[model samples]
Target: MPILQWLTRDEDTRAVRSVPYRLLQEESALSCGDPDAANMLIHGDNLDALKALLPFYAGRVKCIYIDPPYNTRSAFEHYDDNLEHSKWLAMMWPRLELLRDLLAEDGSIWVSIDDNEVHYLKVIMDEVFGRKNFTSTIVWQKRIGPDSRAILGAAHDYIVVYSKNLEAFKATANKIPLREDQIAEFQNPDNDPRGPWTSSSNFSAQGFRKNQMYKIVTPGGAEYYPPEGRCWVTIESEYFRLLKEGRMWFGRDGRGMPRKKTYLKEREGQATWSWWSNSEVGHTQESKKEIIALFGASNTFDTPKPERLIQRILHIATNPGELVLDSFLGSGTTAAVAHKMGRHYIGIEMGDHAVTHCAPRLQKVIEGEQGGISKSVNWQGGGGFRFYRLGPPVFDEDGHVREDIRFPTLAAHVWFSETNAPWKGKGKSPFLGHHDGKGYALLYNGILGDRRPDGGNVLTRSTLQIIREAAAKKAPTFDGPLTIYGEQSRLGPTTLARENITFKQTPYDVRARR
Candidate 1:
């Protein structure tokens, strides 16, 4: 691991600068009143919201499901749809950092991606989250049938599951909507109070050596025996005990071979495995049909996930009231299913399209005005969410200074991304006038403007004015690094060195991070 150091007293030591990064909307705190509120819709750069969530939800989330931009090189119009391979890795690196932190000790994150970045994502996840934390890369049959024109049908998508720590988290087993064939297996042969029952094999393949050679009497005096070279898993003593206890069953005539009865009411549902095919959930056809049934066939977005598909994932990955977060909420399908299932959810979408598309769809589900799974599915819908968006980015923007930006936005940007903790004062800015040993820091868009709303611009004025003012009391230097943003030379070389602080700025080109 590389070291990110800052606050070096001497020029010899590197400053600590490696802090967790996430996108959060810079805004006044919006109140939704359900502190244990199960639902949230965060609108901003995901990098920030994810960072903000770390403080409260670190190791607290139960399930995380994200369907990020697939890197298909196809534009979504709303999201800046492409990042070069390395850039994509860099962009995802920080988000993964925060995701790992916010996950509950026993929680898991499921990422949905296609062929483009799946392999690379797996490797990076292994590097950052640890390969030991890997659960499985479930191959979902994304399409039900054949479209034979192509050399091979690209009919599947992969859902990669990862845990915070290999031994810490596990996905809760989910119940599948009982199918007719499964339901039919249970019969009320004796019309027991349990409703229905299914028979199970009671014979074991080990341990029952004495019973291994025992004979079974049939209804017509025929003696049936264990096959050659095989032994019962249990002893003859236990078989007799089971038979006496009525756990074992012979023919209705009470003279046939023995079997075990599995009462339907007593059995937990079948356990789910990793394989998921599109037919049970839905493929493109089923996905589109669902959209049409709800919003009409004409409704379309560059990309939309099927609700049934989301339900399938939620079904296997979470339980009631568990937190389910979707950083790439697209159309809010995860929230929709989670809400219907009585789970708490938090969704983060960066597109302006959220207000028009994501919000409305979620509202319908909450108000019970929408049908979630339109086919033979039944969803009991009820729950709510509060919506939020990022305020303006920083204290400065464009060619000239904008006086309207608040001090808080600047402070949050500094401390959250800074290498140091125990930052003094609030708001998001790095500057709070003259103080003691530590203060705030801010550098953005090639502009490093650090000054409080009150006219204390410390860099140009005092370096140790406070330390001398109160001889008995110690005050933190209360100024920040005179970091340079944009081109270092734009602010003049002599001015840059006088501040004696580190300078950093974002590269403007969309391609730079890669």
Candidate 2:
């Protein structure tokens, strides 16, 4: 079968190879360095780190919030930002696989994206995370009013929500602090058994079916009924109980149609809405002001979200100690917020700025240095993280290994490059070349000293002797091909084919680096 059966024929398929997806192999690597630590700062390729995180976090995380690249061609020039639709799909498929493995059965994943790839991402997510798990596409107003150009102002971004299991997932409570103005609404003039209270409409719009346009008479013979076509939210049985319990309110002298008393003391904030505009949360301008406040004019992160905004999200989505992840950890706002709230967090970034910007920012949060709500929260510094790079990409410019890699990275790169190569690169292997395992891998750093002074060169003779001796020590009768990696024609033609030896040159036309 064709390897790229999932893609259209026109779609350019980067050659795929098998990679041993990067996953953490060390048990100690999973522990919070600080006994008091609650968050993680992982500095490595997310694709690899996510894979490494699987064993420890699978079916364990409560919520995941990733600001993955929007595939905004303009936003990511450093990574191959301008992928054709199919190519971009190719890019995300595998990472989603690992992410799914890490999600708890009751977990939720919130992805942020714009129009460039929203629809496409939805389809792919359905396939990877299961359509049954889909929750809602919460719209966030990233910008305010109109730009007055092109069809839409492109002012909004979307937060795509998906659940590991629909029946099992529920958003956490969002407790908006009581405001001074709202506090005035409370009163207990009659001194009921319950504490403070507030009056609410006797009618409710839900399933009222206009039957609740009920009329009742006050002591003064004045009669009142709900407006036409409106009905009470509560049933008559419950309404009467409230009246008997003094939980119902009526005008001056025990008035006309009664209203229910919704005790302000008992109520939480308003229910969260799916569509959040800048007014509800914040605007881009607000985000800019925050950047200036935190790091000053000297530092400016491309997309900085307000701490309060993140607080709202954290409040709605998860509880303390639950794991939260941010793969596109731009300025580390998510991690910083999660940490301050005492939730376990993992943040991944591919930029150097993550170190200079995100690391320091998080360290500051840990120390509880800056004021604001963060300081008031009483967080103390503790947790630590080890930063790792992806070493080198699997494929080189020309179809050959860029260089030999350490054991773990080599295993992961080999697996993914073969399965779902996340990176777009010229065809080349990171190893010198492929060879039999169990013994020394057929490593031939091609004899660059081909033009030796002593009458030509003995590079092939030396290499052949090395391979035969290495294999002889392991398997006496094992005389296989000496698969060597080298520039074509570097060592001239060899007559080793008769000795069960093959020397295929690394292809020279591999994709070049940017």
Candidate 3:
């Protein structure tokens, strides 16, 4: 496979490892509506914020949508859209890696870009999320009208999509609801009792199969056979079965070519396609108008996506109560749409607009403001989101755990580092959890009521016995190798081996740094 290279390619690709995981410090004052809602809006650089989220949200997000700076070499009021070619690539590589880590195995990501860097973006995404995972590049008509002044009027943008696993995504992906025009295609010409039905004209397929070239006699006693280069869609027996069930259709004169009558009641919906017209989803002009209505004309966001566009994505990519994430949250269109659509979301933005624009807009959404897709989804609103800022790193410059780090925070990191999975255990016990035939335990910050070097924080015979009891109480069925994190182990190497225990020192084997 080919790779995109630049001056800082090596360093940029490895940049995610160097990013110290920081804490998400929630601002209770900035939160609104239901305090316990799972929605979150974070104010921080996306790279660091994504790293911070791994311990809690990795492999959990069902859908991710990001609209990064297009690097169009033009100035914008909100985003720094201008950047050197290599710099743009460098900026994106590590973030893509982090986003890949955050995605569930059956999940997918949608990225919005333009001609400025879309080709390069596709190459890197193929590298990060495997090429086989590449789904489609949807041509979204972002502009309703053409830019008449340009040599070639640009009216579209590309939405590059990729799934974590193609087969898994296909198994669970939703279909797009049929539009009015599409539904109009199904009509009851004969007033069949089944419902509105549509006819499939191509009864003969492009293949030469002797078994499928049988003759078919219409109700008018006119016979038909497969064309020169084709065969009937089904064998004679299946065709006779369908004809007996009244599933065959002919023209009003009863002497036209035979067709299949498919009833509307049997159709789930329409499958998604590559081209998305402005009339189907929405256009940029509609997006700007939405932002203007929410924030007013004077303070409208520069490049907000229309709520209906995000709504379309969420509808196909996720179900209700699934997790959605957007690191380049921009004007919070993804969050608002996900909220109204009943999917939990985490929106990260580095700019102050996170507090100013994103939060306020979501507040309106929670308040039942009937803007954007609120009426379309029948959003009466009542949910809420917590606001957070990037806090101190989990580890300081010296690679030591921060003083403010508590048991729950360190435990989450320890579990994630050990198993590469989210921590679902409560911090009340030293036993973290078990994964893949290994039991993990963490003794930190007085979780066992004693923090002394020789007490609960150390792996002594007594502490080992306590941990064993807790593990047995939790799992009960079987025994496994135990990997425990503590300050020190008083047991000898022979005893440790006999007990099937591997003890790692705290703050050293914690994996807070690369």
Residue 169, model 3: Cα distance from true site in angstroms? 1.6
Estimate TM-scores for all models: 0.66, 0.65, 0.96
Off by over 4 Å in 3: 452-455
- Candidate 1: tens digits of C-alpha lDDT, residues 232-254: 54566776776665566665776
Name the regions of candidate 2 deviating beyond 4 angstroms.
1-17, 23-38, 75-80, 148-152, 171-193, 204-237, 293-298, 371-514
Mind giving the per-residue lDDT tens digits that candidate 3 earns over 270-360? 8989899999999999999998888889997777899889998999899999999999999999999999999999999999899899999
Residue 313, candidate 3: C-alpha displacement in angstroms: 1.3
Sorted on TM-score, best first, the list reads 3, 1, 2
Summarize candidate 2's per-residue lDDT along 408-490 as a digit string, tens digits: 33333333333233222222222223233312222223332333422112235555565465456546765444444223323
Q: What is the model-wide C-alpha lDDT for candidate 2? A: 0.60
TM-score of 2: 0.65
Q: How far is candidate 3 from the true structure (C-alpha RMSD, Å)?
A: 1.7
True-vs-predicted CA distance for residue 27, candidate 1, Å: 8.4
